[model samples]
Target chain A: MTLQSSPRAFDPSGTEEFAHWLDGVRAWAGTAAPDMSGWRSGAALDLLALPVARGEGGAGAGFLATCRAFETAGEGAVLSGNNVLGGFLFAMSAHLWACQEPLLAFGTDEQRAAYLPDMMAGKVCGAFGATEDGAGSDVMSMRTRAVRTDTEGWCLNGVKTFVTNAPTADLFLVLARTSEHDSYGSLSAFLVPRSSPGLSVGSATEIVGPAGARTAVVRLADVTVGEQACLGGEGAGFAVLMHAMRHERAFILAPAVGLMAGMLRRTVEHARRRSQFGRPIATYDAVRERLVDAALHLAAAQDVLRATAGSADLDELDQARAALTKLHVSREFNALSNRLADVYGGYAMMPDTGIPQLIHDALASRFYSGTDDMQTKIIAEGLGL
Target chain B: MTVDDGVLTVIREAVHKAAPAFDGDDETQLITQQVLDSLAVLKVASRLENQLGVPIRDAELLPRNFASISAMRAFLATKGC
Candidate 1:
């Protein structure tokens, strides 16, 4: 798995920006994983400083740039067995910026100006606190309470599960029950700062892939927030979330396109180098078919992703596009990874071969940015079925 | 035409176009295709707004609104059609 810098037509710089970023991160993950339990904190800070914005061709730089970044992350993992948490963070931050229209349409100016900068800079990580133990996809069923304090401020109370970067998060856009039970209007989004009293994060939850990608339980016990903390007005949280989701889906899937490309390249290269029956395995028809299938899937996924990203401003159309893209890319990654694992034979089962890591990373895609099942359902209900 | 009927027609068509992206042929199939997911709902809302020239507020774009053509027409009618 000697990772030579390869040129990609998609990335003119050949992912030099991301390559340098990974080198530093790999060093940290290798040398510091043991001593730095708080390494995530530093990673968070570094992630904020990284030049992954639209200005430096980073966040809000559009889907092509994001796709390149994801591809680079995939390459780093296959070649070096390094995690791409920063890639995820970069994509998420850019996503927030890319879908600013709906947020600006609904969010107050002060709220936008105050949070957008930090979020873009990565100094302040944002979490979508919509999922609960009881309500995963049914966001309307969330029970987190947001009662008004005596001082005309808001206080949030409830447990939020599966919140990424929870403990390291500087601010949380929390959805809480504002009105009453099962009432759509009752739900509201509040910006709860980590420093706020009574706002605490529980222990980090473990996932199969992205071990250091910190996901934690967020517990708010009467955590009070000022008037500015409220997003939109009473019962506008759902709208805010829907808007954010459009952005999340588009940006998140951008990287997935790249991930598959990376996997395809690796599998092809491996086949070319590994010998079987006194010749390169790449000569075999079966191996060629697998590569071709992966390439086709990658092509389809990339097409859908570009279309989705191009139509980012087209309202709900973007949502449908994002759902479609995410579904295609995630499923494609799942299938491609399995094929690569089979090609690698017993080597895939060992940590030393890097195939296992690639598989783990691919597994995360199916579950991230909402599950494939969730994406299908969105597409289905949109048809009025 | 009342504002409601026009809106309802637009909503129905958009939902119809988006529905085929899902699995079932009719509503009674009890099978959800990929098009019914959250992403598809967003597309339906967009198509409704684009085709019908009526702004369907994010809050109003719920699963119930797109339950069926008849349901959508009725919902539009009640919204000051």
Candidate 2:
């Protein structure tokens, strides 16, 4: 049984259009099959293309609608035991935040015309190459260099780690230093194709959770591209990344919301079915309290996510709101997972029970986008402290 | 184009509030000079948006726009503030 909270309940806008779009996503996600081949399933592609403009081959849904879709997809993944589809949703959402959103916001007309159609169709996959071993939160410390060529364009050489979708990505939005100086203006973003002569993707890194996501190290050695490849101009990498992070952090926890809801659903069902001491375990104060607490945390997280996604639509979502949303939602999700584990008893440790997967994915949520510490710093600074 | 002294005053107040330790003139590079980090830049944008009643778009959050008080004024003028 699903939670009492309908998909429409999380939608703060309350428009019929958004409600209808969410319904469509729920129906599609319910029946969509998992594809472990690293390519996006057709049904998944349809959902991924929802937020793009109709002219760009999408359903013309807005940001809030897209986030709700991700949340629904997460719930569906839990019900169906399809972590592959869940991983695809996560990776594709990264594509939207890092590649699609940036292109829509800052890419030139030719760049959009060249990339958007195939990207929307899932004919090409894009990965974000920003994080490095040396520079995770310290982005300005990135050692990737893009030196100018004697002819035209520039040559890039660097290593980007933790690149999601790197194994199957046809394109990568690589951020590199254009100037030797270690400053914000020194960096630039480049859209390098996987077919580039000096570009290679390393074997996928085995992450603890999000089992199907193909993250790996991407290496570029003197990879050259034209001036047209420069996104948001020569010195705008910082701005591009900031813009992406604001939206990314705001919406990244959507799947966790769904996962928590799903975990609650399963735990409640198990409690009702599993009997102890001549009664159902759900009747006991200990089990019931855990269930109630999980529900409360889920409700609070849903509200925060809705508010943050709405702010993004209004273009008023700042770093503080985004960080707070990430911080609150992820912490609640992790906590809920632990409580549910207690309710599941020994079954929680078994692979078949699904509690272990839920716990792992929930833990992984706190680290992605930014750690809790990073979010706190952003919120504190946003307060003008 | 000339910038109004009033606009400059608002910019100065917002920057100072965002970065209480910042001590610079209108020509001082707030971004390049490292007086304001990325989060501080957002705080400045938010404060300016409230004081000037003009919304700052994400695309407009470039370092060049917040490089200095003068650059901010020039940006505001473009926004028809």
Candidate 3:
């Protein structure tokens, strides 16, 4: 379904369309198994394929629609297993640039056509291969290298760590060093199809949050891709990633805000219903204050997130705002989750309480799409400090 | 007069404004470290852009631009400061 008018970016104070889209996503998610693991390969594919089906004008959804869907999914009991997370990450990474005017800012037209349709359709899932074992925040230090081939294509070499869904991904947006010119010109992003030779996903590693979501080391042992695989330009990977990351952070953080919203609601509901000292904990001054503080933070985060996401759509400021949004929301979200656990008290420590799970899930937000420190550094540099 | 003077003055003002939030001379010495750590530079960048009446381009937000008051002045010069 085509959008009525491009969904108008991501407005927290927007109309009922946001609520309606969220309700539909919740209904859809409700139909699935509570365990996100079951949806990993199949249902996850369908969700990723959504944008493709909706078409570039948008699937009658904008950043707000995507955010609402993420919120619905966040509230559900599903583990944010690799497949689930990877699908959304890939979809957002691709759509962030391709869907906008002057198509294919990062990837070439051929790359966009081949990947975007399938990526948007979810027929093929992609992983953002950025964080190497040696590099997390320092993009300039990435060792993953891509050297051009004489016949055609490029050879990729290096390993990526914390790759959310490499095991199941159909392709990867691999950021590798293409030139030794300088730190800025050193890195580039490539659309490396998994079917390419010499590309393999190593053993799945267990992470603290999002069980059943596979995190694995991706080993590129001279993986080769046609010239078409080059995204944007050879040395332009740094630019591409900078552009893509803005939207990626915005989209990812939107869901994160939703997660905070979900956690806050649960915390409040528990406080209101549960009792302590002969009255509901909600009646206690300290608990009430904490809850109120959490609410305010949630509101403020949403405001920042909406403003940052909107600014991205309107202007090209190298995605500094998105980084700012990520840093703020993720940091605040961690605090919010801690408050939630404090409200839950001992129950939060129990494995089955789900509060423990939520807390664990909250911790992962700090690492992905660049750490909070990294976000701060980007914001600092962006701010011209 | 070189634009460096104005840029340095703005940096000084931002540091001073953000100083109250920080404590001690040691911490104050590390203020540059903290402010430049993440996107905090955006706060400083906005301050300079507004104060200097110059649009800060993305490339101009690099360390060289903020490494020193002198560096910031040099960066602004490229923007027709």
Candidate 4:
């Protein structure tokens, strides 16, 4: 029987193409390639340097290509029990969807040409610095300040916490208050380079999950950038950030289906191999019910994603749908992984099986993009009641 | 027999559960005042949805809809909940 796998959800050609592309990434990384310990310094850049991330593969080859490649990588790594691949994809997705896409949309033509090439080639790593110590959920409350200097350039000062890739990022999309007072239009985004004198990537941050990315405190003490560094300019930060959040919600599920597929396949294989009550445990009604229930959830999550992915603009309704997809899929995948562990009994609990790790990672993902509660709010907003 | 009283009580309880600092004044800005973050807004939505037997659609999720007890009553009244 063809084992139910994550790759099966996509066309065979998509799957095959991604497999080849990812293998090429691995080949490029060579000794620096990802391993059990997690991401290496240069490895992630090489992975991001793929044609899809650069959006150079043409029509179905750029955005779609990146999605297919990551999904395929997630499936293979998950099925073969690679812990770090999912994390790698998580960080990469955040960078591509949240950082690069916004730059393309809001950045001046000059800005795109200057940064996109190096970023796409993985030569200059980048991170979005928005979540401050006090401004996570309430982004408008951010304390970071940017004062336009005499030369029309700006000096930024603030501390952004829990920034993924901050430790290694060469470019930072820093959001700060440009106006003296707090209001909707007070914020602005700036493209600051790591070599800037006053900017510093503070201590490394330790977080939950195997997302193969680095996190740290990004502190800007009078960090200065030229006038051309403004992305959407002053007062545009909030809108830019909102756009990022909406897209983050939509595409963050890029690797989720692959994860669920891995869980289903592993669980089915476990159910078939391990015998209980003188037969394969799959014969048990409770087991069958759990499997059936999981399949339904996975299928439902898939349907939501399929319906929502085509959205061109993440308007209110699209945002709501994206929120639903992220909320439902992540929750279902988390619960399903935990159930699979129960099915494996003692074996699943063992580290070698990777079931327990999957459970932990799922728990980590619960709040990664936005929590279930947050998603509920978004969905309720979409419904208009 | 679920009336405005019931809806208000559920909203109050949910608001307090999410942020005890919250008060149910009709014009209080729950969002701007930080009485409820996105997660708390969701908690309130769930409680309202379950108690009123009325599904809160996404379009009505603006601050004006859940800003206060009076706002919530107006919402439920419009829905005939």
Interface RMSD of 4: 8.0
Which parts of model 4 have CA positions greater than 4 angstroms off?
A1-32, A35-65, A313-317, B1-81
Q: lDDT by residue for model 3 over A130-179, one digit each (tens)?
A: 78867877666888989999978789999998776667677777888886
Q: Return whichever of 1 and 3 wins on DockQ.
A: 1
Docking quality category of candidate 3 according to DockQ thresholds: incorrect
lDDT top scorer = 2
Q: Rank the candidates by lDDT, best first.
A: 2, 4, 1, 3
TM-score of chain A of each: 0.80, 0.92, 0.83, 0.84
Q: Candidate 2: where is the Cα deviation over 4 Å?
A: A1-39, A42-45, A55-57, B1-4, B17-23
Q: Rate the local accuracy (lDDT) of all candidates.
A: 0.60, 0.79, 0.60, 0.67
- Give a tens-digit lDDT track for model 2, residues A99-142: 77787788999988888877876778888899999999888899
Candidate 3 chain B worst ten-residue window by lDDT? B23-32
Task: Give one clash count per candidate, in the order shown.
Answer: 26, 0, 18, 15
**Model 2 reaches what TM-score against the true structure?**
0.91
Sort every candidate by TM-score, greatest first: 2, 1, 3, 4
List, residue by residue over A1-385, the lDDT tens digit for candidate 1. 1223211112423357545545544344333331123234433424332323343322333344434444444444434444444334333443343233334546676876776565544456666677899978777778889888889898888999978767677777788888664534456778778898998898878776643456789988889899788877876666667766656665565545555666677778889999988999999998888788778877877777766655653343445556777788777767877877777787778765556655776787777667888888766654445
Better of 1 and 4 by TM-score: 1
Evaluate model 3 with DockQ and give the value. 0.06
Best-performing candidate as measured by DockQ: 2
lDDT per residue, candidate 4, A1-385, as tens digits?
1112222223324466446555643333233334322343333423343323224321223433444455655666667666556666677677776787678668887998898866665666678899987987677789999998999799999999988778777889988888755544566889999999899988768765645666899989988899999988666676567667766776666666666776788788889888977999999998888888778877776666655654432222345666787787787778777777778778886877777667777887677666788778778865654
Local accuracy of candidate 1 as per-residue lDDT tens digits, B1-81: 234435655655666565664433224221122335444456666776556556676556544555555556666666664
